[model samples]
Target chain A: MRFRIRFAQQVVGFFILAALATLVVVLILMGLNQRWFDRGYSFYSRFQSADGLTPGMPIHLRGFEIGKVTSVDLNSNNRVNVVLQIYSEYYDKIKPNSVLELEQGTFGIGGGLNLLPGKNLLPPMEPDSFLPSTDTLLGKNLLAQGLVDQPANNDQMSAILAEVQTTLSGVNLLLNNVNSAIDGTSNNQLTGLLQGVNATLRSLDSVLTESAHGLVPNLSAITANLAKLSAQLQDPKGLIPKLLDPKGSLATILNDNNQLYNEVQSILDQVNQTLVQVRGLTQYLNQSTPQITGVIEDTRTTLKKADDVMTGLANNPLLKGGIPEKKPQNATFHDLRDEDF
Target chain B: MTERKPNLFERVGATTFDLFHNTFYAFGFFWNVLGETFRFRSRSRVSTQVLVMQILFTGVNALFIITLIAVSLGTVIIFYGNQITTLVSTNFVYTILITVITRELGPLLTAFIVMARSGVAIATEISSMVVTHEIEAYLAVGINPISYLVVPRFLGVTLSMVALNLYFNLSGLAASYLVAQFFHPIPANEYFGQLMTQLTPTAVASSVVKSLAFGFVISMVSTLNGFRAQQSTTEIPIIVIRAVGQGFALLIVVNILITLVFPR
Candidate 1:
């Protein structure tokens, strides 16, 4: 009985030990699975707003999850500060200029922080150092449109409202100016000036019509006369052709050794001298005409005025006393005596 | 006069009372066994002959059926897995296989097999012992029947379950690879490498934990139900049937609970 019991005890012990060993092995394997012994470096990122980001949300680099968010806190600057722990194996890949962006996935699923590595080959960032946070264009647009909450003062909407108010005021001022210009006194003056211009244009049109009517027949007569003269000149046996022909009488006379040509040249010179004298006389007449007319008109006016004065004296006898007598100059007599001496 | 019907409150009270009573009794039995097993100074109470007998009956005897079912299931999984591979990366196929087999199917199928094959045997054997007054004989001889009878079977079934589950996983994965070879024709080394790459320690640990828990429930429920048999010889078969049913139900519930707690 004792031997049998001992054997049973061994069997039970073996089974229990095997199970415990299996559990221990599983624990070790789990530790390996989690990379529990692997060295990890910590870093942080600062976001303006947390959005949907939470602790334990994975941080991915190039689509691979290298770490997880360890903590999310509000910093002094009122930004969300997220701390992360990445495995040391990927330390070299993280540059100092790396930016962490909170990317939202499609269909509202799988949103997380993605690290966008910088192009510069700077040294890896120190552990616990803060990485810069970038707001995606979607996030910025959403914030601008007031679809997302702003962590700080909402200045975008206020600025837009101020601009809109300024624009409205400007439009109001423009409308007022337009109204004043439309209703001011200058508008009536413009209408009157336009009417006067229209009347002047009508008179000018009548004058031009009368001038055109009177000039048309004369111009037609002149043209017909010119045409007749041109026809005569164009005739082969015309007098102008006969005179200008090289073998004609005028041509012979106008030749180099002809007496008649010299006489004709002397006559033409005399005629040119007469024309010069006439041109001078006409210029003198043109210069003196306006002055002569003015003098004559003045003398006539003075005579008429004297006649009027005499008539007035004749009509009223008291007016003669009011007229001043002509005074003789004493200096004239003395001067005449000295001259005579 | 018509029979008086029990009120809703009385019915509810009675049901609640029965539930608590059964729960507490099962918990008490489980606790006692745990305590007795831990009492290392009383190691003589467990018999080696009986432990070996139980392991042989439960573990060795159930191997052929477990292999048959596991291989067939593996073949079906691989046949469908070939279809899935076309849609996803081969790595994703490994992930799906590991998630299905290691996380859910392996421990469950092994538990069901042990329950159906050995659970009824343990319950009926214990019930027969009870009916023949063998337990009374043990008590008269100043031996605790629990230590002599229950402890060996408990250790045997639990340990055997864990071992059988490991075997099931190996055979299942191997047979699946064989079946997959006919369709996809992947090299064995590369296939295993891909599987190992996707396999995680947590998945294996969860599988182990699930099997451990399942084994505990099956052994405890079956042994408890067996010991519930009273003086009637006819009660043995009823107790055995109840043990099988309750063991299966408990294992499935435990599997679901474990899965919920440890999702991939």
Candidate 2:
């Protein structure tokens, strides 16, 4: 009988109403968050493989998620046909010549497919049409022709990388002088060569560590990474097994290998060729930005042993069976470098 | 008539028959309560007071404890969720929050609260009404005890369950966002933004459906046990205990069934 107060009823009403309000708010927020009411534009892109690509992976433009991978299908051509659902608002950015690049995460980590809009101010491509991938020839042509918007390479990041490149080149120059240093002393030249290689890795690692700011830090974390990578390389029990473990490069390499080994290898070869020819790898950088960073460090690490190969081959004579079994005949400089860097 | 005790086979058959008979009666009870609820405008006004009082006792009174539990649980999720953010995306952490707090735990935990407080109370109160002949008084006055006693409570508990579940979701998400600030300052838009995107209409409906089922099960079990009371005062605690236990068992079963039936 005491529970029959009008105020109690009012309190109940307020409680229920508040909850109803929250429910309404949640639904509204969900609608907005999911673009429930927005007009969606559909488009498809073909990739050589579906590695690192999944339905609902975001389609980013300048770091903002503008859409998602709506579906992944294997088409008649035996290629991965990824359908994209771009929001109507961002549809204007999907002009002609726009291409998609599946960005693999650093260290097999966080990445999404980026929408590099056409550099031309042409109209948006029709819905349900194909968008080429940068992995394809047409995509490379569009990129080389400056038709697709690559990352805005401002002078700041360029200048920072140039400083690192200069330091690394100095290390290379010092290594080039190793032939003369080898004429002087054996141990001193080897130690200096190793130091030069490490310093090169440290500088590159520092640049990527501050990738967001595009400013290179004082190279410090390189020693730890080098130590970790070297421990994987120098483990005594087995030659290849330890280097292929989860802690080593092979595990990370295999994670991208389901359908990605070819793409990654081609890109690495392209980067190596580009480095020698023009010092430019900005085009392939969009594919697996972080992966390139890891490979570069690994390449520099293996480059340290290149001098060892040079020294041994320079002095040793050819025999019927090449040479007697060395102490750690398990690994060679070419074998290690070919597998990792 | 036979005076000897029934054999084992006869006893087993009788118990099995009783089980089915009781199940049939329970369904009838549920349909009647649902019918009375739909016919609310035509019902007696006194039951409105009962409904209001039921909500006051069940929903309004339980707000503080609900907030305390919701906040702590939400904070714990965000704390642990961030630790694994590297393996999964930031958006993924928020999505897990929506799935765990809103979809799974919200309805179930709130129903447990209501059942503990109001379900036990409903059974005890109704058993006392039966013992004191108040139920018979209502029947003598041409009023149906099920309609007069159980229907209002059924509606009250059902409505309160829906409302309380919503409260749990809101307070839990809000508290997680606040607590998440301590680990790393997450932009409010990004935190809530990902949660909103991850939340689906299917999930929301699933949660609401679970709440309704739990409320229906708890209220019906409590009132059914109340009416099971015999002509002794000692039966009140027995019926009350039975009601709480049945409410718990039914809520869990209903939750499982709903989750399985509606794969969200």
**What stretches of model 2 exceed 4 Å from their correct place?**
A1-6, A47-57, A71-82, A101-112, A119-121, A133-341, B1-5
- lDDT by residue (A58-91, candidate 2, tens digit) is 8988878899998999888898888899998898
lDDT of 1 by residue, A1-341 (tens): 55534464465456456646755754565565445687689998777788778886767776666777889999887878789888777878677556777856433344577776655667888888867666545434433454322233223345678899999999998777556555553455555666677899999999999999999999999999999999999999997889889999867766867677678889999999999999999999899999989999999999999999888886786775766777976663455446754
**DockQ values of all predictions:** 0.03, 0.34
- Tens digits of per-residue lDDT, candidate 2, B102-206, equal 888988999999999889989999999999999999999998887778888998899899988888888899999999899778899987887887788888999
Which residue runs of candidate 1 sit more than 4 Å off their true CA positions? Answer: A1-33, A46-82, A99-116, A132-341, B1-24, B67-95, B173-205
Local accuracy by lDDT, each model: 0.77, 0.84
Q: What's the count of clashing pairs in each model shown?
A: 2, 0
TM-score of every candidate relative to the true structure: 0.54, 0.65
Lowest lDDT 10-residue stretch of candidate 1 chain B: B84-93
Considering only the true interface residues, what is the Cα RMSD of candidate 1 after superposition? 6.5
C-alpha positional error of residue B76 in candidate 1 after TM-score superposition, expressed in Å: 4.4
Among all windows of 10 consecutive residues in model 2 chain B, the one with the lowest summed lDDT is B86-95
